[model samples]
Target: MTTTQDISQLYPNALWNWFAQICAIPHPSKYEAKLSAHIQQWAAEKGLPVVVDHVGNLIIRKAATAGMENCKTVVIQAHLDMVPQKNADKQHDFVLDAIEPRIDGEWVKANGTTLGADNGIGMASALAILGADDIPHGPLEVLLTVDEEAGMTGAFGLQAGMLNAEILINTDSEQEGEIYMGCAGGVDAEIRLPLSTENTPSGLRQYTLYISGLKGGHSGVNIHLGRGNANKLLARFLAGHANELGIRISDISGGTLRNAIPREAQCRFLIAPEQVTLLNQRIAQYEQILNSELRQTEPALKVRVEESDTQADKVLSLSAQTRWINLLNACPNGVIRMSDDIPGVTETSLNLGVISIENGHGRALCLIRSLIDTGREQVESMLTSLSDIAGAEISLSGCYPGWKPDTSSPVMKIVKDTYESIYHKEPDIMVIHAGLECGLFKKHYPELDMVSIGPTIRFPHGPDEMVNIKTVGQYWELLLAVLARIPQKTA
Candidate 1:
């Protein structure tokens, strides 16, 4: 047996072992077959009732132990999929490989790829509770949904009348101290720009304008942080000089994920050799302006302009390049509005997530998120109008509803009481901007009162993802306390 630097010593005995075993599985989004099966097998081994839905969601129900029979059943929910993101140089296949997670004191992180600690830790907690007989609790049902990252396919496909639990605890929140009661609804707008090119002007030199090194993050959750969008910024520069420098584009590319803010974007094209000096001067001026704008949030923003390997024969058609710049400049990025109800919260936002030029087609993707339906519609409608103007093919997907918070729930009072009893302090209750499965789950079980909580995680949906080992214990304790306090049904 190969033991690759164990970190089981960091967590409590049972949970430590459970998390370690979970880290050994490769459960990337849309590729959760093995992980789902492993969960089913574990349930079978424990002699629990386990069922796999049509979409591979595994729901395992453990009957109430002797004394806890009368207590209400509590659903512990978490996704089984992980985001598969790695650094530009790392070469690990998420579909066929497991994360090599390591412990840095109290923080547990992966080597180079994303740790999947976001939901994996939550799943591990649920499994540990289900597997152990020592933990004190009421009747428990674990709902392990698949493909949460790419889309909430499992949550969407959940059959009616499937769950008996009237109260749910979603252990997917990233922050440790606060409880998330709501989240913004989101949708992805995909625009494919048709490409048609012409010949390059002779005597023009080829150059590559590159931008990289900005800390990209979740478009919805971190959009208000003032992080720079490389695609939009790059377009600003190109639009400023497209005609002045006789610039022509060959190709344009940017960020990877639709849910993440674009950190880097690059464009290759030809410009007059004599105008290179002028271009350099303009680039420096733009860099200063952008740096000043993003100083607080994206301090490490970088831009590089270099000479390209062109045989003096290839260059983008002037007409195509012109249209591309027009579209890029027209596309919207950043927070659209501030919430009127919740002070200091962004009510609506859009991220110009991706751009690609390939095979005579230039495509762009934008993500729009909002707590209010009208705000979401406004931004999406604007994108559709832009697509029509640019003559680009457009599509949208991954639409999800917002989880409107119920401040007067009886379950909320129970949870607050439990927390106060355990820690002697009030837990901060707020809503998050990131997408969560609770919204969809509530659609199926409207009577269900749900609240989400979890350990502190940093840099989620990115390669530097890490979960605080200490907070896991506190979160576990809180969940168990809530479960134990559920009102018993009188026979």
Candidate 2:
């Protein structure tokens, strides 16, 4: 894998240079100390005022250029961390290793991990604007937040009085021309079930059920895509075998993050020896059935079950395992409602993103999203009650409010006009299903006017993630136009 430094000679633009430098540091959420230090060092070198918050968020401000002092102060915001995920075969460590980003024609991507371009581009744009003393601009502050992927910890932990910008330009959306006016609030619920075990029957055999190759994505945005949830499917198989073959689970694990649909899952357990041939036949039948069921959306789905080393000790007692399997099967995943306000938009969705059996206990993690607060609460309550009924202890965290759309704001108009003037067409303005830091920022700065825009990015939060190289220039032009056209603030 070639590091960013090795490609600097080939693509040497200042914006790309900045991105490459950031890529050299491993900045996974909550593990962003090194990346934050780099930003602080850059700010000190430029003689800019930099503040380091308790959660590692860094805000660096620069004085307005000579003639732009009277212009309103604006904050360019982006998260400093990226989701740490990769191909199962990849050997990179997200905490101590740098991402090896590569350029493919007009796109930039990582070798086998997510390209941090989702927010790396935002960071690069801020750096480019701040460093360009010759570029036309106004008083500016760049807020680089940490732990955005894991929980928005940086924004959640923001101090009472840390910022002064009255206008925020969030460069975190993926669509280049579209302006994200609002976003959905989200919460993660973790369900844990106690364990009990039973001795294995003699002449029984162990089998591992494996599901992989499904196209997993951000649970909120892609839940409606009908992507296969391997955890749920695996549980269904185990439940079906509970009475027929005397299946007792040894271990079950799937999905790494709470916000991503499970692409792969594997379950190891013991089954009656006489049923080995019968189970193999059933596995083949299930692989075919799943293929047919998910063929339209998850064409690459694969399901296989094979014999594995039997654990000396059972993972879940018979009773506990039965309840756990029942809970997994009962939990819902995928789109729950379509937007009544916007035609063809998904209004609410759910994802059973993670399941694990650890230390003889089982835990399930799920994420639910909705544009309407009432609907979100409805779904969350359902999951809570369901977990309780299953006798599993439930905990919810990382809840953040949504950004209500403001279609008539002056800042919103300015961004729209800028895009029309530059692109010669109207840009789409819509609300996203995923969470953004803008909502949290609004809590602290209620009077702050905000609009989010960014270059085109695809498959964010996954290893196939990439950013459009050409759109970067177009987005930069639009941002500059918006700055130049900023109306004088009312006293």
Candidate 3:
């Protein structure tokens, strides 16, 4: 009974070593060139044929084992990039500083930053198999894609016929006991609310009203958890009293990534000196109301008002302030629809993920996701209508199709059986709410059967991300068992 959580000494040294090596390098989304090069170099050293596509996806190949020459060629897919998120006090840079991972009680986590275990653990398992010769398997191909966090650039740009594997195993799914057969499609809506400044009103004092201590998680996976969204909460206070109290905005900033639910948000604004007491009262009142409303979901939710001496010559004009505050309050967040076909599965949702104001312009980004195209369209149309009515400009980007679930998938059956054999029970076979590259891969390789599996990871795309250590060993063992049990290619 080893109770060590240090990943280095965790069971199965090869896989953990690979993950540790990855953490030493900065491979944040849109900045995977270094990690890509490192993998390519490792492949070259091992004499395996590695190809880097125009979009920077890596396909490293290995020959079948002695007795499995007739088995189906397998493609194990994992993304190379991790979402870059950090606590406000954490001084680590995603593009420059390496992630410092440590052992918690039962999980491995980073120091006030994302642990990168979402796909890093999966990627490491693939590399472990690729670097080994004793693992029994058919022809193997590891498709390491880039920019999977910010966008599915590598998966979308993957050229057809590049991989002849009849089956693909995606190592990006979150939980260990559930095997993902499909995933949602998504589109990002970017809002640009025009800004104009008016001369500061007289007899005003500056203050920063902030919402913090919210436990934000992945927008797609945790949207239904009813956690408090800092951006929306901050807007509620301002929206309720902006006009009555004449709260002139100086600058507003919240959330970091469009794919992450905003954990904390703050606004720096000006108010009449006499209204300071009233503003404090409002925040204290609202904080209690919010905490009660979200006591079950967000236990640490906090709202505060602090006096500030920050300089500001002008604030948003009355019209701009009204529109911005209105849009924030009206924007929809959280699960909008539930799957009628799949019980307890989210069918459609929207996350008002990031909001910021700078350089005379304010921007708010919303990410829409749905299991069906019509579901996504309905939300997009609704967002467009809201933006238009609020006099805000909106544009849609990064639109990707959903991975429709196939209940009769052959490879999924194999994976399920393997999990049952290992754990003495059936694994949950279902579609995921989050976007995986499988949708894009299925578009390019319609004949290819695919399934996603991974170790248990919690709070991805944020600073609190952690991976369950025990599940990593189980996930690795199951992946190897599935490969060894892969049925022979049929003529």
Candidate order (TM-score): 3, 2, 1
Identify the runs in model 1 with alpha carbons over 4 angstroms from their true place. 1-5, 200-205, 310-316
lDDT of 2 by residue, 79-142 (tens): 9989887887899999988899987877888998888887998888898788876766677889
Which of the predicted structures, 1 or 3, would earn the higher TM-score when compared with the native? Answer: 3
Q: Give stretches of model 2 more than 4 Å off.
A: 1-12
Kindly report which residue stretches of model 3 are placed more than 4 angstroms away from their true locations once superposed. 1-5
Candidate with the larger lDDT of 1 and 3: 3
Clashes of each: 1, 2, 0
* Candidate 1 C-alpha lDDT tens digits along 399-439: 99989988987677887788889899998888887788888
Of candidates 3 and 2, the better by lDDT:
3
Task: Tell me how many residue pairs clash in candidate 3.
Answer: 0
* Model 1 local distance difference test score: 0.83
For candidate 2, which ten residues in a row score worst on lDDT?
5-14
- lDDT for each of the candidates? 0.83, 0.83, 0.91
> After aligning candidate 3 to the native by TM-score, how far in Å is the CA of 387 from where it should be?
1.1
> In candidate 2, how many clashes are counted?
2
